[model samples]
Target: SIHLLYTLNIFEFSNTWSLTYFRPTVPTDLWDAIREVELSWAFPGHWLPSKDPVKTVYFSAGRQQWIETCGAVTRMKGLQSFTLHLSGSWFCEPVEKIPVFLEPLRDLHLRQRWQLNLPKQPYYVKEIRNIDGDLRKRGIECSIRAV
Candidate 1:
């Protein structure tokens, strides 16, 4: 059954042509299967790095829907991890912004880890380390790796 599945990846979605915009929602029927979610702004093509790499999870969805989704995830009893695969050097700011981006998941008591998959040519290592430290304080294990 789909409910027995353990992972889901919502990498990209589009209305037409290119993957310019998307607002993802896990159907209630499959929420039981969502142990991990791998999200990216654009899917890889022809073995090439995506031009529109994941900058952040601060998607501009409707505010109410965003809150509702956060509530849904918080209710998930089996959610384990969320992977944010960053494809470029867009993380120019300090660790300040990461918390707000991640605040929605703070209520996810069942979530055990948060992984940041970075590009080979990552930009701010120190900033990443700082973000890691902040998440550590929240008791969530964070792993950063260059893919």
Candidate 2:
């Protein structure tokens, strides 16, 4: 069903497709390395914590950590058969406004939790302020805001 989903993305299925994950929430590298991906855009059956909602994926890693995980997935060097993840607006604003020029990203899964004085490093970030950043080909500036 990867073709279907990929085509769906190329076509116009974002509005129709539900923001849910029904397989492993792995990274693109892992998925591509695996070579086989099961696209079951359905909600998972397993239970979870965190009142903050989340779609399922293959890696089981948080969406916030996707880029990092994708870059360094030690054992994630193969095609994947399934993926599950949640997609939505979280802390940092999404890159959807612009175009997707990065790796093969099917969708975005995230959650925004507005907490102040956390142990996070940033050039400048307030508890209830909007996060901002610039994305160049080499890197990107990111921030979070409680909209």
Candidate 3:
């Protein structure tokens, strides 16, 4: 099973393949040190191997910080399900940005520290609309709760 941990600034995988996809709002020295360690230990082999499949993906982000990047993961060929751990604050993106192909997602778990706000009707009524609308549309069963 392959586990990919996506933090605010760091994107790490269980196979030791990791990268700093985006610059995080943190100290330069700290980021550099962490990056150095990750690079040194990262496996210099093919990512997303066919023989050894990726079982799960773990993602942590600050509110809507990494919406675009997270959504991109849906494009992966063999990704079936994923777990999203939210931190910092609650956030939501437009329905268009949400992945449409969620049939392959068998187990969707969302663990959040703060409140989660999804898009709502009337354009503005709730702080977070939650993912019921999006997930329901795709017939995806998800378990969402606060951590």
Candidate 4:
């Protein structure tokens, strides 16, 4: 039954698509199985690194959907550090959204020159600084670097 459901879900949705039907209300075991299937579909084979070559991993998702999809991949065990490379005008709501999505991330590097409406306010810088301070207090090292 589980296998059939998994196969059907995969067949209906493309590799990069999300299973919107599967929510947190679902049974724990079933939800875990679905997540495993999604992960497998996203990364076909041999996704893990053999040698621990730099704990930091680089990821860039131009679309909002891809960001949400990759967010799950980031939560996987053994990925302690990350660098999010943003290109184009991706409107990332740092204050409300990003922090929670990237919870428990020990080391994070944000590389982006944000084009904000209020250039004088420097909201992006201030937000990053606040996030950095908050993360630091929780023993997480957050830094911004040039892309």
Candidate 5:
């Protein structure tokens, strides 16, 4: 399991793969340091066979914040593992648009670690499953947990 610790608007990456992230107002030095780390793409039950540079990301921002920083995220060419803790506002738009927003991450290992916060309606679940299938066909893994 990965833990996201927030403290004084600073983001830190620990040896245990635990990530810390706050608002986009965090210091530039912290972000620069993050881009310089050599990280192992290992999780609790699964392990990656290779090493990468700061490939893991845990992002949890509101819709407004997401809009403000989505461009930066899309430009992250080295990202491999990403976890998104979704908020309700994420569903304000069409669910299909979610994939569109993440189109830039097609090369990522995007495994099943998405945490969704939405009602468990069959329509939403089915749509998400379809998206998951599409991503999987492209060699991307996605799993949604409604919480």
Candidate 6:
């Protein structure tokens, strides 16, 4: 059908365009425009690096929805609601590696190893509890249900 062919062409065009022109210096506006694409029908990003490259059952860090090289967060922009299927691996960030920018994330799920000989530190629990409390204060509905 013509619709399928046209879409395929657009996909091809976007793919080629990303490879030919997507660059870090291309400016955020350009990235936004590229992101305004028909994302659901297209697969963009194969030229950028993921915001987070590692994942584990206990943790996953960074973003991985880039549109050009397909390794960044280009597609996550403006998304109001959706399901994010993340894989759990062993190489995720340590409890100590949490960055300052972690505040904006609304949902957090942490599954730790049952056999760890280490006890939960006050700082870690405080961080999680603070984030949870903050969300609860705003009535956003939060929890740490068992996994």
User: What is each predicted model's overall lDDT from 0 to 1?
Assistant: 0.49, 0.29, 0.32, 0.38, 0.39, 0.30
Clashing pairs in 1: none
Which candidate number would show the highest lDDT if scored against the true structure? 1
Residue 146 miss distance in model 6 (angstroms):
6.6
For model 1, state the Cα shift of residue 130 in Å.
Answer: 1.5
Candidate 5 per-residue lDDT over residues 1-147, each given as its tens digit? 111222122332332223223325545443433322211221221121124433222222223333434344333333333444444344444566556544444543422342223345555665777667665565544465444
Write down the lDDT that model 6 would get: 0.30
Q: What are the TM-scores, per candidate, against the unseen true structure?
A: 0.53, 0.20, 0.27, 0.31, 0.39, 0.21
Q: Model 6: what TM-score?
A: 0.21
lDDT of 4 by residue, 1-147 (tens): 874453345322333354333334445454444322222132221222225343213222223444455554334332222334332222333444444433534332223221112112255556666655665565544454322
Of the candidates shown, which would achieve the greatest TM-score relative to the real structure?
Answer: 1
RMSD of each: 8.6, 13.6, 15.5, 16.5, 14.4, 13.6
The full ranking of all candidates by TM-score, starting with the best, is 1, 5, 4, 3, 6, 2
Write model 6 residue lDDT over 86-113, tens digit each, in one string: 1122123243322221222323222321
Candidate 3 clashes: the total is 4
Residue 38, model 3: Cα distance from true site in angstroms: 17
For candidate 3, lDDT tens digit of each residue in 19-66? 224334434443333311111122111211234333212222221223
Off by over 4 Å in 5: 1-28, 33-68, 74-82, 87-95, 107-118, 137-141
What lDDT would candidate 5 get against the real structure?
A: 0.39
Pitting candidate 1 against candidate 5, the one with the higher TM-score is 1
Q: Residue 25 deviation, candidate 3, in Å?
A: 22
The 10-residue segment of model 6 with minimum total lDDT is 110-119
With a 3 Å backbone cut-off (N, CA, C), the pairs that clash in candidate 4 are none
